[model samples]
Target: SIPDELQLQILELCDMTTLAAICRTNKEWYAKASPIIWSDIDFVELSGDGAYDDGLIDQQRQFFATCSTRMDERPDFWAALAARVQSLKLTRMPGIAISYKSKAELNDSNDYIFIEIWPRDRRNIYDVIAEFKNLHTLYLFVKDWWEFSSIGESEKAVAHNLEKLTNLKVGGQINQDMMLALLSRPENIQHLSLINLIHSPGQDNGPNPVLFLRSIQKRFTNLKTLHMSKLAELTEDTNITGARWEFDPAAEIDLLEEWADFLRHVSATL
Candidate 1:
């Protein structure tokens, strides 16, 4: 009883799962809607059992693998899902290892509830990062910082590819090198929310890069909001007069002059 044009429109909005349900209505509908429905998939909540499933994730990877061959684009299937996915909330990792799936329960008030965490294999994230090019906002509920230390050690960090990202909220001591690696990329990141930034001393003889104690404010021109705690070092001065400012005097440095110059630079620019 459906018109051809209207039927096609409906098919465009449905996924493989819903298409299967629609197709059961009639044979003619099945023939017309099958291709569009099969094009992309949503697999975040695959199990009705309400627990993490390693086998299910593997099955999804395999399904995408086969779908990629047919589509002639290795990332087409994942890309489609990524584009559709607005937000993903990663909980603890699956069993037999550290879980990334959230211990928190979902509420109807929250728009973000479910996200896929890294597999038990620490290295699997390299591929995960490569897959989600359209991901703009990421929430990481990580238990271990080491789970992500190697992320940027390669050619570049995942931030390079996620050009659309505007906000990032994370927990843990994200390494300074990794942060710098991301900031170096020419992208306009507006907001960075972090907690527990446990900074270790850097090899640089001067001020450490992580502390933001030096003249590196120029690096984060687009940064607007910063949520953190206990960041300032005692070496940094609160004196607005700029006269009491001191650097390492053993190296024969004029602290006041250098502070004045930096102050002038900041004033002139803003």
Candidate 2:
């Protein structure tokens, strides 16, 4: 009965689109009859409107940032909510402004000021994601190229910091450098889905980037899944050793087989 009332209150406060994520907290919650909240909000349509200008995104980001900054201030609040959250879906449009306040306390040399930025830049986004440490599933729906690049900026941090994350769905260009950085981390990530990875044409005579990823597949023992879609740079002679190994076929075979075995296992699971 209490959960019913709490669910109703949640329905009133949360965006209707987010109800699916809320109900996924547990089986019991999903079994209880309730309207799908998202149908009521028309999120796909209204999301393009100025929802952030009315102080929704700022309020939530600030709330979560404070909870993360001060462990003692709201320990119970953060701990309890972390249990309920399983999937987090994020969408960013150009010109959406988010405000930031450092939770660090006052000191003689310390300065306190509010920072504001649009979520269309890579470097700024890293600062924004420092708050969400417990996220497991992240889905992004980017509308434009700028939005796409911004998501790529934060993907590295998401893979490294969110050690609990198993699923990541991105609709953007995932560069080889970012992928390598993610694979280098010693986290328990098992699933990686990159959609529409467009190859930027350049005269890069260095080691082929895809070979670098294959190398990482050999090195990262826990990687279980990789889906590379719409990649345009597939070539047969992309060399990993480039002049380092002197084109040694035996060494290449060993490395390639190691990576192939890992990918084969991941493919079977998927």
Candidate 3:
């Protein structure tokens, strides 16, 4: 047998099927190879109308459900396996993905697309987060399709000790609730990306998006990189003034002016 480190180095390059076979060879091999296989995972679904030719969606859902169940039944074992996960990516399909564009303008969709993020049960969402204590990079988008979020960021379940999290990217309308919650608790984050921070429509006077962005910049000043997709969303761009890029601005004129002020402040801060 090769040295454990060298064995793991070779095993790291092997695909899942090959690793599965090698793992079955013996308990020792399985023990050595297990963590490498579960370290980085992409929870994705089939493209288009979510018609899984391979039932991939359900398979992943079952896998997630099984993992969540293990957390409840075998806390130590589940934690050990889940802690091995250092990088996690969640992607929803295009049409149903996170979007600030309308179908009429984008000309991409003729109908609405429904998506799901935690199919097992809403509680599984938090339960799953609690498992990955060592997560370093977390990208979440379109896990579930909900216009209005039922989850809150301030909830006790969301307070998972994410001391290791450094990178966060939000591309779609996946978990607006989670995004909002995470923003409320910005910790040790170095990289941040927000494509479209969708939330329940806000009033003109308060809870402004510009103000929201300012608060985020101030809270995450340690951010080495910050990405905001629709720059026009926070400012007055004469070129795309009427572009209506994904932001509803509530058609409030004062909101637009405040957004322009927010843009100036953000530019100066950066």
Task: Please report the candidate that would top lDDT against the real structure.
Answer: 3
- In model 3, the clashing pairs are 98-172, 98-173, 100-246, 116-143, 116-144, 117-143, 117-144, 142-174, 153-181
Model 2 pairs in collision: 16-37, 16-38
**Per-residue lDDT tens digits of candidate 1, residues 1-270?**
888989899788764557768878888776787555443343543544636564544444344334334334545655564455333333322211222333342222322212233443443332343345555555543323123334443326464566666666554334555455434432355666654333332223322213321344444456556554322333533332221212234321333343345344344323
TM-score of 3: 0.63
Count of clashes, each model: 12, 2, 9
Deviation (Å) of 6 in candidate 1: 16
In candidate 2, how many Å is residue 110 off?
A: 39
C-alpha lDDT (0 to 100) for residue 23 of candidate 2: 73
lDDT against the true structure, per candidate, is 0.43, 0.44, 0.53
CA shift at 29, candidate 3, in angstroms?
2.5
Candidate 2, residue 245: Cα displacement in angstroms equals: 35
Model 3, span 1-270: residue lDDT tens = 678788778988876556768889999889877777678765542233535322343334445556767877998888788879887765543222222223344454323332232232345344466467788777764322234434553234445555677888776443434554555556476777776444432233222232244445445545566676542344432442232333554634444564465446454334
Clashes of 1: 12
The lDDT of model 3 is: 0.53
TM-score to true structure, per model: 0.42, 0.42, 0.63
Q: What's the residue-level lDDT of 48 in candidate 2?
A: 63
Please identify model 2 stretches exceeding 4 Å from their true place: 1-86, 92-123, 141-160, 181-187, 199-212, 219-227, 231-265
lDDT of 2 at 204: 35
Write candidate 2's Cα lDDT for 1-270 as tens digits.
Answer: 576787676665765445656678787655442243321322233356534332333334453355445444676665554444455555432222233443232112312122233344523433334334565665542222222243454656655666565666554323555455444442455677665432222223312223344454444445566765432333533442222212134434543564567566455444
Residue 249 of model 1: what lDDT? 41
